[model samples]
Target: MTELDVKDWLVVESLQSGIPLTDRPYAVLAEGIGMDEGEFIRRTADLEARGIIRRMGLRIRHHQAGVKGNIMVVWRVPEARIEEVGQLLAKQSSISHCYERPMHPELPYNVYSMVHAPDPEAARVEVIRLAELTGIDDYKMLTTVRELKKSTPVYQRPEE
Candidate 1:
């Protein structure tokens, strides 16, 4: 893992939630974090190359964009064909995220997906279509009854 210095952590903390919406957002951010624009850009690029930052992009609020329903679909995919099925599900427009995980003693599901839609029925319809497309019959949808927490994890050095 790439280690972050104090200044790097400060920059990460400043951008943990959001970036300024402006013509020169990075310049504005660097000013806020007490760094010049050129250094800020260079450090960000270095972080990316070192794997300290995997991705930096906008996370659109699905509900704000008129997607009202979101369901967590867990599928019991056979170990033999997990890769093929996961790739197919991940490619779907309706499926925002698809992951393959290990099976447990009690839990039979190994593949999971998040499907968001305009309504419950729409989400269910997408799940059905996704099941057909992935060629996996065993699956279940855990409806998002309550949003307890939603956040992006941020890391910073403890104050000395």
Candidate 2:
């Protein structure tokens, strides 16, 4: 697969806010980057195929969109069943992020997942359902009372 060129990176940077909502958004972006519409579309397709760009769409802040609570759930799943439970939890649309982490001998929690909902009760319900599905009777659900920091800056430095 061909790697992303300078123009491709420029296109991605330009799309951080999302593609323009004009009748011809791609064309607008192409013109901004001094490229024709066909070239812009072709480069975007190639970037996607190569997994350089995941998707071009709206980036919504859930809290601003009526989601009042964000919960981080940690489960003490048995080693043998971690993958199964993780997969099950990941399949739920309520789960915005999910992953398995190494558990310390002193700390028994391993599998971790995140669920965002309109309220704490809704988030708790989803976590309870996950526990039932995974047969994880013991788990800790930590709801963020306040967001300290929640911004992901665009990384500009390339690894040496």
Highest TM-score scorer: 1
**Candidate 1 lDDT score at position 78:** 85
Q: Put down candidate 2 lDDT per residue, 42-92, tens digits, no spaces.
A: 888887888877776566888779887679999998889888888989898
What is the per-residue lDDT of model 1 for residues 80-102, given as tens digits with 9 covering 90 to 100?
89888988887888888889887
TM-score of 2: 0.82
Report the number of backbone clashes for model 2: 0
Record all residue pairs in model 1 with backbone atoms less than 3 Å apart, i.e. clashing.
none
RMSD of each: 2.4, 2.6
Q: Which stretches of candidate 2 lie over 4 Å from their true place?
A: 105-107, 155-160
